[model samples]
Target: MTRAKSGKSGKSGKSSRKSSISEKPSITADSSTAAKPSITSKSSSDKPWPYAAGYDNTPEVLEPAPLTVKGTIPPWLEGALYRSGPGYEIQKGGRVSYRSRYTSNDLRERYKKAEAITGVTFCQRDPCKTAFQKFFTTFKMAAFGGPKMGGTDTNVAVIPTINFPGLMDDPDYKKKKGKAGPRNLVMTTDGNALQELDPITLEPLRLFSYGAIDDSLNASNLAPAHPCVDPDTNEYFTVLLTFGPTALYKVVRIRQSIKGPEYEPDLDVLAEITSPRPTYMHSFCMTKRYVVVCHWQCDFAASGVSVLWYGNAWESFKSHDPNVKASFYVVDRHQGRHVATFEADPYYAFHTINSFDDDGDIVLDIAAYKDHTVIGDYYIENLRNETGGKPPQQAMLRRYRLRNIAEQAALSYGKKGQPQPVPAQIDFQLDESVNFELPSINPSRYLRNYRYAYGVNRSGMNKTLIYDRIIKVDLDKIKSGAKHSSSATFWMEDQCTPSEPVFVPTPNSTEEDDGVLLSIVLDGRRRTGFMLILDAKTMKEIARAEMPEGTVAPHNFHGVYVPNSVAA
Candidate 1:
C-alpha cells in the first residue's frame, strides 16, 4: 500500500476465480510471428474470447454472431452488439478488456491519440499522462495467487498474486496484440512477472512465480468484504470471504508475526455464513456482533438476467419453493457462532453495505424492481451454455438501516435449532403503512478508512440511481424514488464518474490527517480517468480533480489507499 506521488502509484484491490486453473496458450501465433497480431480476424492459434464466445472452438465459427445478436439483443438495443453494459455486468462477465477484437484495435488507436495529448498515463500512458494517474489511487491490490488456469504445460504450476485489470495497455492503444490487453495477475516481487506454466499439470514452467499466494485470497470468491486493519497497530487482516452464495460471516481470522513484507499469511477463513440463495456478494459490513451482507444479481450479457439481494439473505433470493420472492437477512453472532437470524421481503435487493458514518449505524443500498422475473443459475456453465438467470424487470435505488436489523431478524427465523425459518413476533407488530425517507447519508468517515464502499448512486440520464449518488432516510430522491414508495427515503447526491471510493492521505501531506475519500472517474471520453474528492461528513463533492487522458479506471473491484507504511 505504498504511494508513488507523481510518477506511478499503488494500493492493491483484487478479486478472482479459478477460470482455467491452468494457463491457456497466450495466443496461437508462432513465437517468431508474434510481433504483429490482429484481433479483427480469428487465427488458427488464437483462442476466441469468452464474452466473444466459444473459447475452445475456432474463432471463425463463433464469428457469425460475435458482433450481431439478433434475437438476444433487442432491435433498438442492437447497439449492444458493440456497447458495454452496466459496470456490474462487466464485472460479473469477467470482462477486463472491452469486447476483444474490436477493443484490441480501438484501444491501441486511442492510446496514440491520448499519448499525443496527455502523454504516458496508466501503466504506460506516456510521460505527460502523469496528471491522470491519480498517483494516490494506483496502489493496485491482488487476490490470491496460484498456477495459471489454462495453456502452457500440463503439470507445472505456481501462484502469483492476481491483480484485476493488471498493467493496462492504455484504452487508447490501437490494435492491441493478443495476450496484450488490460487486466492481469503478476508476481508480487517484481512488476513484470509471468506464469508460463504447463496446461496438463497445474505447475509453473519457470522461476518467476516463486513467492506467490493462492485461492484463499481469491477476490471473485465473493464480496470484497473489506479487509480489517487494527487502527492502534496498523496490522492488516483479511476477512469476510464468500463461498458461492454463502457469506463466510466472521468464520475465521488470520494472524502474523510482523506488520508488512516480513509476513504475508496464506489467507485463512475467519468467519462463515451461508447465503440462502446461490449468490455472489459485492460489498458487506461488520459490526461488533454481526456481519451484514448485500446480494448481487448481475445481467452479464452471458446470462441475460438481473438480480436483487437483501443483505446476505441468500435463501430469500432463491425460489426454493416457487412461492419465494427476494428478501434480506441479518446473521447475528451472540457468543461465538451464528446464534440468530431475521429477514424481510419488501421485494428489494442490495448491492453495497457500509457503516453509518464511521461510528454505528449499518447502512446499505437496495434496488426495487418492476415486472421482475427471476432466473436463478447456481453455477457457471460452459461458454456455449447460457445458464445465467434473467435480470429484474427494472431497478430503483432504496435505503435501509442495519442497526434496526436486529428487530427484523427477531421476526425472520425460528429458534436456534429450528428447521425452516418462520415469521418472528416483531414482524407482526410493526405498522407497514408509513414511508421512511433518509435525509443525508454521509460515507466520508467510514469510506475515509475503508477503501471500498458503494458511497454514491448514479442517476441522471436514466431514472434515479444510487451507483452515482449518496442517499439518506427522510430525503427521497432516487430517479424514480417517490415519497410514497413505502420504503426508506434517500437524499440524492452526485459524485464524478467514480464508484468504489477509497481513502488516501492528502497529496504530499502527512499520515496523521490522512483518511481522504478518493474516487477515479473515466469521463467515457478519450481522456484518462479523473479523480473526484468528497467530504466525509455530508458525502458531497468537494473537488473534481482533473487527470490527463489515457488514464485507467479502477478495475471492477475495491482498492485501498494504503500510505507508504509497512504494507510494502
Candidate 2:
C-alpha cells in the first residue's frame, strides 16, 4: 500500500480562519518524573484543525490507565469492548504511489486523443489550457513518483514473500525489493489479521490469524473486519478472500466447546467457492440456513496480474457498474455447497443489519447506497471543513426479499426435462430512510426474525458526514405502515461525533431491546473522547466513561463486546 502524508500544515486550506482552542490543565501519569502537561498548540492545534476535518496524527501505543466513569458501571455489563482501526502514523522512505503507476499509460493516451480532437496544441487556450496542464502534471508526477515522508502505520507485520509467492517476478516488486519492504501491514479497510486488545485498559494484547493460532488451520487470507456469530450454535463465521492460481472465497467457521473437561476450540473451512472477480468488499451477510456473499458492483481488476501491478486494493477498483446486477453467492451452512446465485439491482452496502429465513424466503436488511460516492467523500481532503461540499447521499435501511423461485418455477413453468434450479428473485421492501448506517442488531436475534435495529443517525440538514445521533428502529411497526419508523433517538451535542453503536444484550432478557448501546464519541470542539452508554430500549444515556485529559482517540470503524464469562 502506498502511504503518503499530504498537507501536514494543520490548515484547512480554506480561508485564513482559525478556530480558537480553550486551554485546560492536562493530566499526566506521574508528576515526579514528568512535568504537568498543558493543552498547548502541540497537544491541541497540531495536525489538521477542526478535529472532524480528518484523523489526528497522535498514533502512539499508550495504555490509557484509570478511566473515570461519570455514572456507575452496570453489574451485568462485565466484558471487554474491543475496538479496532488505524492507530499509528509513521514516516518511511521508498514509498510509491500505486494510482500513478497503474493509470499513467492510459492517461497519456487519453490526453493525446483529447489534443487531436480539438485540433489544438495542449495548454494553448484559457480554460482548456488550464485543464490540460492540470491533467498532464498530475499524470507526469504519478508516472515518476517519489518517496513520501509520512504515512500511517497499523504496526502489522509484512508477510514478505510468503503470502504472495510471485512477488519476485513482478516488475513493481523488483523496484521495491530493497528500497522498500513489502507493504503487507493490515489496514483499516483491508484488515489482514485481527488484533486482540485488553477490554478494560484498551491495551494491545496480541495479533490473531488462522494459521498462527490454530496449527490445524492453514490459510493465508485477509480477515474481514465484520464477522457474524450464529446465535443457535454460538459459532463465529467469516469469509476469507484468497488470490492465487484461482481466486477463491472461503467461508470459515470457528466453534468453541465450553462444557468439556478441557475447553477446546476448532477452526474449519466450511466452503471454498471460486470468485468471478476480485473486488474490495468490507462485509457480507449470513442467514440461518445460508451465507450470502454479494458480489457488489465495486470492481477491482479481474485478473491476478492487474491486482499485483495495481499494488493497493483501493486503486484496483476501476469503477462502479450500475447496469451489472449484484451477484449473491448463496452457500448452504450445513452442506457447504453452492446452493444458488441470486441477482439483484446494482447497489453498494458497507454494513448489513441481519438476515433471516422468512417462510423459506430469504430476507436481508442492509444500509444501501446508489453509488460509491459516499466512499470518496470519506477522504480527509474532501471533508466538510476542507471542501465544504454537500455531503454524499446517506445510506438507507433497505430490505431486500429473495423469493425461492425454484418452488414457483416447478409449479408455474412445469418440469419439461431435468428441471433447472430457479434463481432467487430480489425486490425492495419497506420504505427507505436516509438517516442510517453502521447498523447493529441484538446478537441474540441474529439469524432469526427480530423487531428492532439500532444504528448511528446523521443530524438532519447537517452538511458534514459525522453521525450526531443514535436511532432505534421498530422493524415490526415500520413494516406495518407506521408513519414514524424510529422508536427512539439519542442526539449528541453539536460538534460531537459518534462511532458505530454496539448493542450488548442483557443476560436472560426476554424483550428484543432489553440491552445497551455502547459507542465512543469524540468531542471535536473540546478535544476529548468519551464512551457513551445508552439504554437500548429508550435511547437514554446510562453512563459515560471519559478518558484522561490529553488523550486523543482516532476514529474507529467497528467494535465487539465480549461478556465477562465468555472472555474468561
Candidate number with greatest lDDT: 2
Q: Name the regions of candidate 2 deviating beyond 4 angstroms.
A: 1-54, 59-64, 71-73, 85-223, 244-246, 256-268, 384-387, 405-433, 484-490
**All candidates: TM-score:** 0.40, 0.66
The most accurate candidate by TM-score is 2
lDDT digits (tens) for residues 466-503 of candidate 2: 56677787877767776554444555667677777889
lDDT of 1 by residue, 21-96 (tens): 2111122111232232222322244432212111121111101111111112111110111101111101122121
Error of 2 at 521 (Å): 0.4
Worst 10 residues of 2 by lDDT: 94-103
The true-versus-predicted C-alpha distance at residue 352 of model 2, in Å, is 1.4
